[model samples]
Target: MTSLPEDPPSAISEGDRDTAVQRLQEAYSQGHISHEELDERLHQVLTARTRGELVAALASLPEENAGTTSTIAAAAGRIKRRGAWRVPRILKVESAYGRVRLDLSRAVIEHPVVDIELQLGTGRATITVPRDATVEFEDLRTGWKDTRYKPRARSRPGGPTIRICGTMGYGRLKIRHAWR
Candidate 1:
């Protein structure tokens, strides 16, 4: 007799699930994912009720984050470098929330900073940084329950440094970094 197919979370699609996992893994390796936080997100992705829910969760993630294929990159999003010597990076993203602009360009790049600024209009966000990179926060506030920053290891020199600033009209924000 033929065997039955596995359930969605179990038989999670490679594209979306894999993407999400990879993003999660990258964040973990970069010292951006804490054990507890990782477990929680993993559970969410696996047990999500609908494809749209999963898609939204994964799609609204920060760059260099970890997870499997479930998370797909947001298209139509833009990241541009305005300056020359000290690149002034600008990220303009349109999500379920309104518009948002993230300014970095001047962020120290010696540690290979990868600043990820997202406009999460009533949406969630996930940002991952190198294991040894330093992290600083400013004007951080959240309305979602259990809003917290996942702990991460510090990054070595030349490793990527990620700075993520977002406007959450109404949502959660998870920032993972490489710092004490």
Candidate 2:
């Protein structure tokens, strides 16, 4: 008598692959791996067919840190963040009468999702996110002008999701994806 073969392992999804890639990028940024290593691992993650392969690609990486919330407030001045800055998992921005700009094109984002809350009064705010990121601002309330945002034609799978909320009083909010 012959026995049936064991069931094949489940295949990995695009989301799974994207998550592995993100973890690898974080590890690379934190100096856990070199450029060549990151390239190799990324290739492995992208080409992985099964969960085991994906897990193997992420071996030896440090666990993610607990998410923390940060607040940035300006009573009557300009607030800007650019260059190679680290983005927290949760951020709150409050401006009474100042312009605020957050450029996240080259920022180091280690989390899968980021939450940004804004409270502005009589000031404008401009936020630039990563090219591959997904932005959501449905919960934002504006008193003067509607929020300005143009989503990517086709957002990549497994990219970070940025959630924006809060209130804008007598001001405008502009959100755009980074070009570079």
Candidate 3:
């Protein structure tokens, strides 16, 4: 007898649910998905407690952030995100003798929280966010490199959260916030 597959845990957090909702709304706005489809998917998103369910609900619609371009700093190269650029929810960065800078003061933030994962080898990564937004850095393994995460507040609370997680090898990771 073929047994049923085990279900994924239904312990999704609020942040994940909000992110899924944002995706559904974006899909509907893009016209790739109809109202009926969006309604069905959105219901699933709101009710979903597991990552698998959320992923399944959003599997049919095209990723709203598909057009959002990601920046990369290759060896001896520098990549920056400034001006009016789309702020991707997930940013991947790697550099050897290079730099990656992202200024979120005027960028389009699609989610409540942004996750930046990086692996640097003798390089530097800088992030500039708005003062209203909250920023946190965790699990950074910088091997004898300079690091700075100073974000002064000038705006009220209840803004988007930015989580930076990565490993640094002989590199610097600086995070600062601007009043905009």
**Predicted model with the maximum TM-score:** 2
Worst lDDT 10-window in candidate 3: 4-13
Give the range where candidate 2 is weakest over 10 consecutive residues by summed lDDT.
Answer: 4-13
Question: Roughly what TM-score does model 3 have, to 2 decimal places?
Answer: 0.60
Clashing pairs in 3: none
Candidate 2 per-residue lDDT over residues 86-112, each given as its tens digit:
688889999999999999876766566
TM-score of 1: 0.35
Residue-level lDDT tens digits of model 3 in 48-96? 8655567678776664665453646587788777876657878777777
lDDT of 2 at 154: 68
Q: Which pairs of residues clash in candidate 2, taking residues 3 or more apart in a chain or in different chains?
A: none
**lDDT ranking of the models:** 2, 3, 1
Off by over 4 Å in 3: 1-71, 153-155
Q: Is candidate 2 or candidate 3 better by lDDT?
A: 2
Q: Write the per-residue lDDT of candidate 1 for residues 64-124, one digit (tens) a residue.
A: 4122111122433432222212222333344664322222232223213444445455655
lDDT for model 3 comes to 0.72
